[model samples]
Target: MPKLLMIAGLVLLLVGMAWQFIGRLPGDFVFKKGNVTFYFPIVTSIIVSVVLSVIFYFIGRFR
Candidate 1:
């Protein structure tokens, strides 16, 4: 559990550091009307989900 938490923390840290460079991924939605702007990261969410799924699969396999 401790190791999993540590790895998760590290992954989050790296993502935070690289967030500016990543900006918005392709297929993400952005709406702008006058002064209102909305953003939804659909592609980013799917990528994150897949990556986490693979990580957990490996962790579970090893355990």
Candidate 2:
């Protein structure tokens, strides 16, 4: 179950990356509101990966 969750998380991250890459925003093709800009989709991906991993880790540990 743990392995399955890890795989699913990885898949989700990959899908998000692809979607970000393929999709475009308005005007300057930006995806930011203020202060920061988003040119790389990998950062969000890493965050997702970390969150998923943590959640899955705890789930596995508890079970």
Summarize candidate 2's per-residue lDDT along 18-47 as a digit string, tens digits: 667756433333467688877654655565
**Model 1 spans > 4 angstroms off:** none
Q: Which prediction has the highest TM-score against the true structure?
A: 1
Which ten contiguous residues of candidate 2 have the minimum total lDDT?
Answer: 22-31
The clash number for model 1 is: 0
TM-score of each candidate? 0.78, 0.39
- Candidates' lDDT values, in order? 0.84, 0.66
* Superposed Cα deviation of residue 50, candidate 1 (Å): 0.5
Residue 63, model 1, lDDT: 82
What's every prediction's RMSD, in angstroms?
1.7, 8.2
Clashing residue pairs in candidate 1 (N, C-alpha, C atoms within 3 angstroms): none
